[model samples]
Target: MNPDIYKLLIIDDHPIVAEGIAAIASRQKNITCKSITCLKDLLSVIASEQFDMCITDLEFPDTNGFQFIHILQDKLPSCKILIYTMHEEPWVIARLSELNISGAVSKHTDTSELSTAITSIRMGNKYFSEVFATLNKRKSTTEGHKIPELSKREKEVLSYLAEGLSTSQIAALLCLSSNTIQTYRKRLMEKLNAKNVAELVSKGKEIF
Candidate 1:
């Protein structure tokens, strides 16, 4: 093994799927690939060895993929993650973006696109499949008329509100003043054309 090689890990419940990804990754000259079929083996390998990137499937037999992303983030803060899944929901992509995931590709994408996604992510860029991009564009076009763009802080407040947090609770969580949180709430209602908090939460659920 080359000491300077980039180490990549592929995690999926399906052994053949994992092996297929590993096979593609191994074709890179400076890349070393390891594939594991379960969370336990993934955790063990992560504990013992450092990886540059991880390609993971969302559907695991025993664990949720979103929760696994959190675990991987905690364990390997510097390792980039690329999601490979059949899920193409715009909200799912939005949630991943909120969580700051490195990139995502649909399972239906070609191996060439997978290699492109890996290369882009490794070079500190986010990659999404064309389908994801197209869906997002259409969603934005339709929603733009009704919803104004939200600032980062406003989006945070809206997300907290959707989770049933009060102004005071959101303020404390975001380390902002109660008045500030209320102001954000008001802005959210206006931008989303919401009549009240209930409506605001409903609209926020759709977009965020």
Candidate 2:
């Protein structure tokens, strides 16, 4: 859309997925890409370069997806974030809202939709693919209540935050805000009555 070229960084634990996104981005006009498949490498790569947008997977072998997003945003505040994940649950949608990510698309989403998402973020707009939109719609119908049983999204965020990802990184993966994630943290603490992050971690491990 804009005349300026966009630089993209992709963080996925899978080599195939990273390569696929890189290939697609390379073929697209006005865009360039760099991809990383490990958290250590991902951090180092971002530190060494600047990017206009970041497309990341939600889960990784070394770190939680949402936490990783938080880390990337903190390390590179100006970079727009796009979540490409297989998670399609309603709570996942709500979690993304909390993180305030720029865009979200399912791994199952077609290339056209993926292109549209990248374009939207590059143009300074947020995009949520149909799969994401549907999840949010379903979540809204359930109101803002959390089941006494923690949902997978909450557990993931909690476990990761406990593992040391800053709230900002968690926000990025969950497509939410650091503050919003803080809310989740506070609520989780209150629910578990853990009183602190360490206790929360212990509880998280017990639950999972």
Candidate 3:
């Protein structure tokens, strides 16, 4: 591969994960990673900059799931869009295809797989994890499978809860009334069939 020919963008909200990807890619002789979190900022930068490929998370603090790919493909039709997410649902795979994503990778996977995904997308090939490929499409057997259908807000609340936020604190951060936050908590528990906070935390880790 030509060292000067490839540039990559990583769009994930987690600072640590983004930095980790940069660190790994920096060690490679022919690849580099630029990290950013916001979609608008990404689009603005991309307009002025050229990237060979993009690896983005399916979720973000400011956007719907994986919708950034649509905007990115519009702006840079030649750039490869790889979806790096913890979501292992078969429907997600179908959805990525519909959006013309270049690849999909699971966060729980090894770093080598990610590096391969980058190279594959850069080479105009699609990548999919073996585990994700083997998962049953008709009935998800993954943990937290029972809680598959989460509202966007519910998914955000669950992530924060796993981060150790109290319901009141989460309510304040989300700008919702305490009662509304409580309602979200209740609904999350019911949907996931969680027995308690501890179980909810455990389950959250499995899915994300």
Candidate 4:
């Protein structure tokens, strides 16, 4: 066991996913992964061990996700929390932010993104997916880059984008066609001087 290794605990209801994630994470430099599939198992193991970070999903069989968070915070306050679940609604993101969870990534994202998230959080920087980052913007500006003002419709689309919605998803929610949403996205990117959708989000957060 390397003394400099980072111990990362993976808490999820599905044992297979937890184990898979642990295996992938173990390949990172000096990081060891541990999986806990149930709350019952966690209670016993937590008392005897300490971790540098914890990645948890908000769903579990024995207890609510919120309860699990409370327990994790109470029992291991020093451990940074990384959210790895599909629940990325505005309310859910906001609640996790209030709880001081350090980072989040969509389940739909690639396995490679998991390594990025871990690295970001390990460096004391918050990690969030494009949409999550848009919604969870912390600093007021990105190097004093002045954000161009947007129209009401554009703002509406931006709001939905911040909530982590896809173009089709936003179109459905707004009762507009996907083409119209695409138009809005293009207009937004051009107006904001963003080269691509990813940069659109990266820059939009400065204003959002």
Error of 1 at 170 (Å): 35
The reply for model 1, stretches above 4 Å from the true place, is 1-3, 138-208
Error of 4 at 31 (Å): 1.3
Candidate 3: segments with Cα more than 4 A from true spot: 1-3, 135-208
User: Which window of ten consecutive residues has the lowest lDDT sum in model 4?
Assistant: 138-147
Q: Which residue ranges in model 2 land beyond 4 Å of their true spot?
A: 1-4, 148-208
TM-score for each model: 0.64, 0.69, 0.64, 0.62
What's the lDDT for all of these models? 0.79, 0.78, 0.74, 0.77
TM-score comparison, 2 vs 4, better candidate? 2
lDDT of 2 by residue, 76-151 (tens): 8888999998877655676686786898999887877887888777777999988888777766677642333586
**How many residue pairs collide in each prediction?**
0, 17, 0, 0
State, as a TM-score between 0 and 1, how close model 3 is to the true structure.
0.64
lDDT of model number 2:
0.78
Q: Give one digit per residue, the lDDT tens place, for model 3 in 127-195.
A: 877756665343345543333567789888998888899989999999998888877776666445466
Clashing pairs in 4: none
lDDT of 1 at 105: 91
Most accurate candidate by TM-score: 2
Regions of model 4 farther than 4 Å from truth: 1-3, 137-208
Question: Where does the lowest 10-residue lDDT sum fall in candidate 2?
Answer: 142-151
